[model samples]
Each structure stands twice: as C-alpha cells, then as structure tokens.
Target: MLTAQDDLIGHQTPAPFATSGAGDARFTERYWYTAHPIDGSELLFDAGLGYYPNKDVMDAFAGLTIGRRQYNFRASRRLGGRPLETSVGPFRIEIVEGMKRHRLTLVENPSGISFSLEFEASFPSAQEKQNYRERDGLVEEDLARVSQFGRWRGWIVVDGRRFNVEPAMWWGQRDRSWGLRSEMRTDETRPPVATHRNFFWTWSMFQFETSALSIFLKERSPGKPHYLSGTEFKRESDGSVSHREVVAVEHRIDWANDPLGQTIANGDLTFQFDRGAPRQVKMHGLPTRFYLKAGMYGGLQGWTHGDDRGDYYAAHDVWNLDDPATREVARTLSDHVIKLESAGDVGFGISEYGVATGYPLYEGPQKFPAL
Candidate 1:
C-alpha cells in the first residue's frame, strides 16, 4: 500500500520515500474469540491483526468492539516517514515512517459492553494498482507496480490486554509515484516491500466491499491455478441495512510457532463458510500469520500487499477456523479447499490460505472478480 508523491529531494520538498532491507521481515499477531451460542461466553470479543515489514510491506484490519465478548481489537506499527498525526475525538489519526500507509480501522460502540470506538478513519492517502488493465483500464503488464507512498493508522485495545500500543498508530508508506492517474510514465520506487530475490506464484482473486458485506477469496490450485485470492463485496444495502457473505478456501499450509507465524492451512484439504452473527463473519482465524510467515531455521516469511490489497495487518485479516498453527510444523501447511458461505439478512465467508515455491518478482495467472 503506497501512494502520494511528487518527488524532489535535492530541490526543496519531497524526500519521504522509504523502505529498504528486503525481508525475513518478522511480524506476528493473533486474536480470536467468538460466542453467539447466546452471546454467552462473556458477551463479545472479535479481533484481527497481521503485519510484515518485509516481503513487500504488509498491514492488517478487522472490526467489532465491546470488551471481550464478541469483538474488540487493536494492532500497530505506523511510525512516520517520518509521520505521526492524531486527533482522538471522532478519530483522525496518521503515523508514517520509512514509507507509510498500510493501516485499518473500524468502530461501532452502540454502548453496552464498551471496548471503545465511536467513529474512526486515518487516511493521509495510500492505495496502489498503478497502471493495471483488463476491463478497459488498459495498462496491465499483468498488473504493474512501483511508485509508492501511502499512509494510514489507527489503534486502541484495552480491557483484556494483549500487547503493543506506544502511540496509538494509524499508517503511511512511500516509494513515490504521483502522476495523478499515470498512463504517461512515472516511476519512483516500490516493488520491494518484500522480496526474497524472486519466486513466481500467481493464481489470483481477492476483492473487498463496504456497505454491509460481500466476500470471496478463491483459488482452486488442484492441477495448477494460483491467482492468490481474496475478495469482499458490498455496494450499499437498503434491504433493512443487512447483507453479509463468506467463503474460506485453502487446502494446505504448514510452518508456525512464530518466526512470523506460518500455519496457513493444515486441515487436510480445507473448507469453511458463514454469514452474519460473527459480526457479519468473513474471517479466517482473525490473525497470527499473514504475508507468508515461517521461521525457526528454514527462515521464510512473506507479505507484500502493494498490488493493492492496500498492504497489511491485512484488512479483515481472517482465517482462524478451528485453531492449528503451532505444535506441528512442515512448511506451515498451505493446501486449499476452504469454504465459508452465507448471504443476505447477514452474509459472510472466509478462506485465509496459501502455498509457494516461486516468486522471481512473482507475477503469474492473475484474474479475479467473482462479482
């Protein structure tokens, strides 16, 4: 997630393009607790988080609040490109350092349980898809990337006490690219938020939405089809303001105990689906390992959401089906079939999965839009 840059340095302004030091980038997080069997297990506590300062730059996101009963969360690392901005009332925060922007936020409050959150957002600008094409947008070297700078940050979590929160944090990132909507030619920096030299793995699909909910993140990969999937949709609902759907697809993955946390899937050919309830559930375990984590000795952890997953903690970072990441390791098990389904009146779905043996500037197969 990198955007916003005019470029200068020796001239007068502009000199915030940051991020260097490839990736073995280690960042691990976990938060999961659900109970709607009667809102019993305490009331509510739902959370999600993930971060990878290596592999290409990654961040995460997920929402639901009210003190550990259904959903309540907070995660961080938005320093500043030196940037750090704050407000607090309704929330208007920003934090950037070494190329900022890769953040997430959600708040409802409705009173009652009270985990805190009324209304929030932190966007100093950070979004990427630089010159991609297909539907008519026209530029698609598969999907070009390079030229970065983005900033977003928001944080707060208390009551149960997990950890991390030095200055609240929102986010921001940079590599620089400001052509406005370039078709002309603009290249500043990017394409290296996470690079293990290069390996190729493509079989794409991942989309997101905001109205109520609409989710899909699929990739068959039986014979070979790795579009690296993710998606969530919701244009705007009037149907009494209720809409949700979810699907989880990931047949295998292994390698976790921290290092960066990589036990993506090991349910032995997986599938998970849902709708509504879990705060319109479309989650995959909610956190712990995202952006390809795995380290003990083999050393391998990954994350690089700049093609425009917008970068990490991973917005809605989901995929915690039944718990299985530590106690056994073997390349962090990633093999797929994960399915989670539900739609309307409350719809939701999830599939937090993966597998990799290649990426030399990894880019292949790319095609996603289950509309």
Candidate 2:
C-alpha cells in the first residue's frame, strides 16, 4: 500500500528536471504524445520513447494514421547521454520550457517520416496517486506519473510531403512515467507465474476546448476489481486552475472476437468525478487501426528487444490489416485510438487493452467477461 508520504517523497517540485529513483532491472522512463487535427482531418500521430536502465537501451516509435493507411517507424540503440536530454538516433525529445513545454523532433530517416512539433502545457501537470503492491514475493512499484493536456505547434512531414500544424487547431496530451513494470524482467529461465496470468489496462486522456480529462485503470486478472485513478482539469476564466479526482467509473464494452477468438473491446465508458456531474464518453474503435496486429504503431511483438547489444530490432513496414498470414503472427497487444464523445464534446485518445497469455512469464486460459 502507498501513503501520501510515499507519493511526495521522490517528487521534484517541477518535473522533467531529473529522473526518479527507479533502480531496478525493469525501471523504465517513458514518454507518450499524441496529436490530432481539429479540422476534421482523419489523420492522427502518435509517438513515444522508452528508456530502460538495466538493459542500457533506449527505443522510440512514431506513427501516422491517414484514413485506412498507417505508416510507422521504430528504432532502438544503446542508451547514453543525460536522461533529461531525450535522444535516440534520429528521434529527440527536448524539454524546451521544463515541465510546461516540450519539443519532439524526428530527423529524416531512411523510412522518410519526420516531424518537429512543440507541446505547450495548458495546465499544471497532475500526478496520479502512487501505487504499491506485492505479488509472489515481488514488490511492484509504480511510483509516479504526471499527465497534462496541451496544444501542439509545428509540422509533420510524411515521405517528404509537409503538413503545417497550427497551435489553435492542433491539440494533444502527454504523460511522463517512471516505474517498475513486471515485463521488465531479464531472467528467461523462470517458469510462468500465476500472477502473470491475465491483465486489463486502459490509459486515456481527452482534450476539450476548456478542460481535459484522463482515466487510468489496471486489472491484474479476470474476476478482479480494477485499480482506477484519474484527474479532470478545468481552466477558469480568471486564469486560475481547478482540478479534481475522478471517483467512479463504469464501462460498457462491446466485445468482438477476432478471427483468432481473442476478445476485443469497442464501446463506451462513463466517469464520475468527486465534485461534478458524471460524464459519459463513447469510443468508436477504428476497424482498420487495431493495435494487436500493428507492427510498432501499437503492437507488442515488434516493440521489445533483449538487453544484449546485438539483440535489438526495429520495425520497418506496416502490417497488412486484412492478411491472415501477417495478422496471426503480429497479434499480441491491443492498441486503439478511439473516437470519443461526451455531451457535445468530441476528441480522441488510446484504449490500450491486452491480456498476456501463453508465454514464459504467463500461460493458460484466463476468463474475462464477454460482451
């Protein structure tokens, strides 16, 4: 269990100033950024990087989804340089104005996708409650996470074609998290553990005109209640900020089975805050953009690598969504950018759902509610 002191202990007054005290094989410092056009363009961009200390490696991925077609680029290399200076090969994430602003840039690579975008925070960063749990004699420490909504300014070039990004018309959200994840283990000889059976996870941040909402949930196994945490930030007319914790949540998942019989969720979610009226949000899962089979765009298979210097691999091609030959081998994780609606508000974010089974660390049939 985590207390208030636990949350305050390692927190720096202003974030992005230094890394956290995550000293383990699985310690990971990661960044996730997403941007979309406000003019009803059917294009979206998602980029992220993860730094693993024990492995001494850093990897990055960036993708663009235009209508039904998606282009992705991924790279991994030996970790070096200052932690605050996020750089891995052609991808660089710099904190231009500390925690309130950042710039993510991708230099032109052989794959031909590049971008130079700036993110200006709309409100002060909100921290999620600290999480501490122990399972099978292994203590899981998810120390701290900070999320913020902001506007993007810059341009993204796809295959040498340039598209301008205006701050007023481009909105996005970003979060920085440093913690110990179960999957960061380096030992391969250990048998599968019951604690690794099945998991359900969702992390979403919705950006609206005057406010932003974020929701996070994690369930370790089937038939277990989930651990939920979230925050809502509203900009006041006087240039002040008001925020609150989201207290209650309920999900109405429209489940569908893929050709492989794996369950997938496509539906609506509702959240209740501690002080405000409940808000209902609807999610429309894009049939063509499912992450289970996506290469580095969102898939789990192509994004990971061994700690050994020679074992790193990067994704180069988009997985054909319709081909069974490619889909079967690419299926592993669920990543979707669902269209969200609540009242008259409309936005987009990710619904990352996955159930890990039949691996060296997780095996066997796990039951979850079917739609």
Candidate 3:
C-alpha cells in the first residue's frame, strides 16, 4: 500500500551499538493468543505498536490478521487534514531496527486466540493524539480461533484534503511468516536492531513538517502488549507547510509497574519536551481497571501470552509542546485538541492535533539531502 523508490527498510549496513551498557538482563517469556467466546461473525483486526528512541530513531508495527471466517482486508486511511485516521480493516503496522532484514506478517485468526491488550491510534489531531492506551481489546486467557486467510493494506490520505500518498506495496497471503517495517536507517549486517524485526515494539510512525507523530507498544509485567508509547512533536516551520524539522519532544510518564505509581496524580510529571512555553494540560482518563487479554512474542519485557489484566489510565493531555531535546517549546494551541470517552474498562478518544516539525532532512540517514 506504499510506493517508495527505496525499501521502507533503508539499505544500510549494520553498526555496533549499546543498550543500557553491559548488564546481565535475562528474560523469559511465553505467549498464547486465544480467541475467547468465539465470535465467527465479527471481522477482528486493526491493532499495532510504535517505537521511538530519542528523536532520531523511529519505527512502527502494523498487521492485519483475521480470527474467524475465511479472509479479510484492512487498510489505514487519514481523513480531515491528516488529523483523523480510519484503519479500514485490521492493523496497519511495520517494524524496523536498523534496517538489515525486516519481517512483515499477516494473520487470519481461526484456531483460538484471546489476549487482553491496549491499542492507540491518533486522528484529527497530531499533537495531542499521542496514541492513548486502551485497557482491553484483544487480550485475555481464553480459547480463540485462527482463520485460514487474512489480508492487510495501507491506504494513507495525507494533507487532510485528498489523496496525497503514492503507494506501491508487495503483499502475500496470510500464510507467510514475514512482517512489514519502515525505517530511516537500515543496518543490514548489525545484530539485534538490524535484524529488521522487533518482537517487542511493532507499530507505525508519521511526520508532518517539523511535527512528528509516532505510536508503538510493549507488554508490561502482567499484560502482553499492554502499554502504548507515543511521541508527539512540533517545530519551527518555514513556508509551504510540510518541509519543517521536529524541534521538540514531550516526555511524560503515563504508566508504571508500581501500583502506587499508576495514576498521573501519583506518578512523576515533568516537561522535558522543550525549552519555550511552560505549558501543561489536564487529562480526565477512564478508570484504571479492566478485564483484558494479551499475546506473547517469544521472549518479551512486559507480558506473556494471553495475558488478562488491568491498570489505570495513567495520563492524558490535550495540547502540550516541547523541543527536540525533550524541552518545552511554546504554549501554542495552533496544533491540537483532545476528547476522551469510555465504555466501562474500554477507553475512546479523539484528538485534533498537528505540529510544525523542523528536523534536517537527511539523504541517507547521515548527510543532509542537499537542496
């Protein structure tokens, strides 16, 4: 569903790196994606995760898998000035480390799959959408089905006016084991990050001018794929709207493992997103409890397979600006608005946000593309 001259996974050689210095971090994991209370009539798909490390490294994960029936189609579309998105089907996700070799997978649930999990997707607003967390959607400890065939597509409607994306993608059936990923740098020879696969953070990312909106996910101690991480950005803009750089990032702790650290009121709050305006927005999130399920991906950090759990709504804000170094920018409402809703443990939100991003455009992840 995308048309790029180069592979979404940048063609680059792997480079050595370090994660949390050298420490013995042993992790054990087990997963079971069972579909509980088998509902063969509903077309269940459309979920994913996004990851952002610092401001420069970005990647997302999306997939479309069916649970019942024979086959299905899912697409991601943005309507209303790139503010709202309609994932017209299942998950629109891709994964990327440092390129190397990324994998893409499609699913059609038929056997038995039920796992408690959280989901995040922003629409109508870029700055405030921050991909809020949904307590439970497809996470639980129960029996589920895995369909025979499943299909996924990405139909992006950028600019908020009409179709502004040129898409050309290579898609196969739901039978393959590959996964999709989009990256700015691809280290083909690297080990972990360059494997082009993220068993953990699998989601999608988008940048408009200096404004960036990235969404990803990770399972927590009790739930698999439980927490949703979002990085909303805005920057000084030149003219013409879409060629600015992302100058800031908003850093706020939404959730934590400690029950005493779950609420925004009890959690740490600091604006490390920018250096301009001293701005803060209040959030009235849904209840912190729910009944959900989760899925395990081999070895993970946050959860195990078919995990059913609950937590507080952590944090929520309408419009807040910050700088590239996680510094606060200016108090500008020129970018976003927010709304929250709930149906018991489930949460619903609509954000109308955008930002002026101004990061230097690099031609090959190193040198800036000469104008």
Report the number of the highest-TM-score candidate.
2
Please report the TM-score between candidate 1 and the true structure. 0.24
Q: lDDT tens string, model 1, 86-143?
A: 2211223233242333232334322211222221222122222333225366432232
TM-score of each: 0.24, 0.76, 0.24
lDDT of 2 by residue, 316-337 (tens): 5655555665545544343455
Which lDDT tens digits does candidate 3 get at residues 144-227? 111111112333211121111111111111111111112212221222321211122222233222233334333322123344
Candidate numbers sorted by lDDT from highest down: 2, 1, 3
- Model 3 TM-score (2 dp): 0.24
Candidate 2 or 1, higher TM-score: 2
lDDT of 2: 0.65
Q: Candidate 1: where are CA atoms >4 Å away?
A: 1-89, 99-133, 136-223, 226-250, 253-371
Q: Lowest lDDT 10-mer window, candidate 2?
A: 362-371
Top of the candidates by lDDT: 2
